[model samples]
Target: MVDKAVALLANLSTIAEGRLAIAREGGIPLLVEIVESGSRRGKENAASILLQLCLHNSKYCTLVLQEGAVPPLVALSQSGTPRAKEKV
Candidate 1:
């Protein structure tokens, strides 16, 4: 269920409005938490969503970084699937 949600949000987050809406809804922390401890697909989805949130937006990028996303993002890039690595 959570994985599905993450994936849906990931897809939606591709757009600027969706990114702002998700971030406004406090989705960043949830995405980070999933990156930290979710299943492989969930991590991928969450990371993808986060990437969208930060894409071309310095404020969101800083927000994601401040939320402690760097470590897990680095870890995912090193050990996650190719899709996940691409998202990172």
Candidate 2:
């Protein structure tokens, strides 16, 4: 169920409005948490959403950094599943 929700958010994040909405709704911290400890697929989806949120957007990137996403993201990139690493 959590994985499904993260996947849905990942899909939603593909759009600019959805990225704004998710960021505005305080989704960054949750995504960072998921990257830290979610299931494999959930980590992948969460990382993908975070990437989408940060893409070419310094504000969102700052928010993600402020939420301390980098450490978990780096950990995921190094040790998460293949798809999760790709997302990271």
Candidate 3:
């Protein structure tokens, strides 16, 4: 169920409105937590959602960074599943 929700957010995060909405809803920390400890699919989806949330958006990029997303994201980049690493 969490994985599905993460995947939904991942898909929705492709657009600015969805990204901001997700962020405003406190999705960033949740997604980061999932990326750090959720199941394989959940981690992948979370990483994808976060990537979309931060990519090419300076404000959100800074926001996620300030939220301490980088270390776990970097860990995922190194040790996560192939799909999760691909997203990272």
Candidate 4:
């Protein structure tokens, strides 16, 4: 269920409105948490959503950083599934 939701969010984050909505709805911390400890596929999708949120948007990047996403992202980059590493 969580993986499906994260995947949906990943797809949604590709659009401007979805990015804004996710940020406005306080989804950053949740994404960060998922990246930190979710299933492999969940981490991949969550990281993808976060990357989408940060793309060409310093505000969202800062929000992601402020939510303490970096450490988990770094960890994922090193040890997560291949797709997860790509997302990170």
Candidate 5:
């Protein structure tokens, strides 16, 4: 099922990426919680998601940016892996 796939994809590393990839497709709510959850992995994932959302959909991109995810993303962009840097 799509929900299972979605849930399965939502781990510490992938949650942000996955949410950004699927946010407007019904992922924003879930990702919001993760972003505001105060977990390191959650924040990292949320930042990644926000950047990816911006890359594909300017509208949602604005939304993510407005949510204040850019700072953490900027940090991640500096030291994250190649794939991680690419996403942010």
Candidate 6:
């Protein structure tokens, strides 16, 4: 339970150093749920992770769009802090 919660909290995005690895190998549904339902920190982190994946992995970016992530990321860009906007 604790491991699950921690994974949910971070959404496999915290490790920006390994963006492609996480996006390609980890569970997308978990990250999607975090992006959709988590706190500000969570959403921001998810966006950063997505940005990295979107930049580094075409397949992941396609998945990100197919999963309807752009609208929320755009919405976040509008109201989020500068750093957040830059990452997303």
Best by TM-score: 4
| Candidate 4 structure quality by residue, lDDT tens digits, 1-88 | 9999988998899999999999999999999999999999999999999989888589999999999999999999999988888878
**The best candidate in terms of lDDT:** 4
Q: Quick one: RMSD of model 4?
A: 0.7
lDDT scores of the candidates, listed in order: 0.90, 0.90, 0.86, 0.92, 0.55, 0.66
> After superposing candidate 5, which stretches have Cα over 4 Å from the reference?
1-48
Candidate numbers sorted by TM-score from highest down: 4, 2, 1, 3, 6, 5
Question: TM-score for all predictions?
Answer: 0.94, 0.95, 0.91, 0.96, 0.48, 0.67
Clash numbers, per candidate: 0, 0, 0, 0, 0, 0
- Model 4 / residue 88 / CA error / Å: 1.1
Q: What are the RMSD figures for all models against the true structure? A: 0.9, 0.8, 1.1, 0.7, 6.5, 4.1
Candidate 2 — which residues are off by over 4 angstroms? none
Q: lDDT tens digits, residues 1-88, model 3?
A: 8988888888889888889899888888888889888998999999888888778587877887887888988999999999999989
Worst 10 residues of 4 by lDDT: 48-57
Model 5 per-residue lDDT tens digits across residues 1-88: 4334333544422455554557646555555555454355554555555555566668877676666666656666686656556656
Candidate 3 shows a clash count of 0
As for TM-score, the candidate ahead, 5 or 6, is 6
lDDT of 6 by residue, 17-59 (tens): 5565565576455556666666666666666667767776788
